[model samples]
Target: MTRMLERAPNLAILYPRALVKRGGGHELPDTRLGLRDVAVERERLTEYHRVCGFGPSDTLPGTYPQVLAFPLAIALMSERAFPFPLPGIVHIGNTITQRRPIAATERLTFEVRTGNLRPHRRGRQFDVVTEARVGDEPVWDSTATYLRRGAGTGAAAPEPGEVLPTTAVWRVPGNVGRRYARASGDRNPIHLHPLTAKLFGFPRAIAHGMWMKARCLAAIEGRLPEAWTAEVRFAKPLLLPSTVDFGVRGRDFSVASGGRPHLTGRAVPAPGNATPHPG
Candidate 1:
């Protein structure tokens, strides 16, 4: 019975002109690739590709966008000029639609824009839409909602809607962290190369964000009613060699570790859906 906020009529205006004026528009300089570099032949995409747990010959994994997308969102939202408290937000859920396959060596300019904004019954919780583009072409898009902790604004929590009970649970082992890094091309030293992690303030290599995402999807597909829409908040990053417990209860779902909740979400069966496959 947690209190939540009612949907706002002007929720879309949260990213006000003032907030947009505070900083440059959503532009990721580092992500943009010069046209000349876009077609260059390189072996890095094929060689030394263990970071994502994928061989150079393998295709980019589904959750690969997190390496750049979420970071870009954080950077834009954290501008001191912006009104919302970026750190206080929780990533409720993420949905990504890929228009085409992304080559590892392809260089391109990337941009993001905040789109739809819908308020949830939970106080201060709002759904935000983010769209990513490469050189004027929409490449991928995700809609994520977040719960603003400690922001007591608007209405009381709504009664739990249709309940979809848990079906199964999965235990994510520490080693899967390493394997995920190898499959994805993200060799961020934080997820591999222990020495690099130490320099970056981590005790050891941590799990790739995408791996955790994949794990979540796997859990949901196994338990909840099929076709349920999921909205999740990333909250804090989960480190390596950690044990994660994923479970479902009624229509509510939760992922936890060390007795602490890492993600909280809900799901329902997809209309005209079939059985889910192992991810």
Candidate 2:
């Protein structure tokens, strides 16, 4: 069942709620959290565009709705019923499908839920799915796979063998996390500062996985079809203050630094017959 919110939940409050629920249950929640008729926050969107290297456009970035729906996603995961703690949950993969280009002015309804609990070589994994609708027509949706490290299962996750050929390079600054957090409202400490990150086992602060995805889409923005799906696997954490190479072959892409792959993904446009109406 869906529970509608009067407004976006304050992340300031939700983060603490998640921390407090650290030792919660092992079952995923069935409740779907939602919000209706929410307009795009133009200022935040602009800041996001700046940080992610996206060009200005009348339409929303394919990943924008994910950030907009993120608070709801957290609300679902922070509940006492959620299995794992939010602090160390690593985002392992993400997939975003846009039925069509959504205009910036469009008001959207969003719903978020969690499920797909499963085992991994290093831990347990689950999905947080978010869907957005313009009126009653579904415009966009995304699934973010997160993992909580603990035990072993089948084989270890596959690794990207050799680095893809480079097409461009990016110099990611240390403060990108703070900039993105301000714009996207995902202030996970691991992405915030080296001190905070060390508390999570990282030598230095890392970049947001979604930020990497957005930057790649921005690099190839003109080539993306109006209706397409983008999927990516986060191979390794992108340490901040790094220089990374981006490679693309056909629809496939990867981001790497010093031949170590950080992310790999593909973008595939929907077939003409499968494209949805923009309105």
User: In terms of TM-score, which candidate is strongest?
Assistant: 2
C-alpha lDDT score of every prediction, in listed order: 0.45, 0.87
- Provide the lDDT at 203 for model 1: 78
Worst 10 residues of 2 by lDDT: 270-279
lDDT of 1 by residue, 1-279 (tens): 111122211212333322344433333122211111122124433322343334343333334544444434454454453345543444545655544545444443434444333344443554444443444655444565556555455555433222233344444455655565444334445666567667767777766555655555544444543233444445345666666666666545555665565655554443322322121
Tens digits of lDDT, candidate 2, 177-200: 999999999988888999988988
Best-fitting candidate, measured by lDDT? Answer: 2
Error of 1 at 243 (Å): 3.5
At residue 48, give the lDDT of candidate 1: 24
> What TM-score, over all chains together, does every model reach?
0.47, 0.94
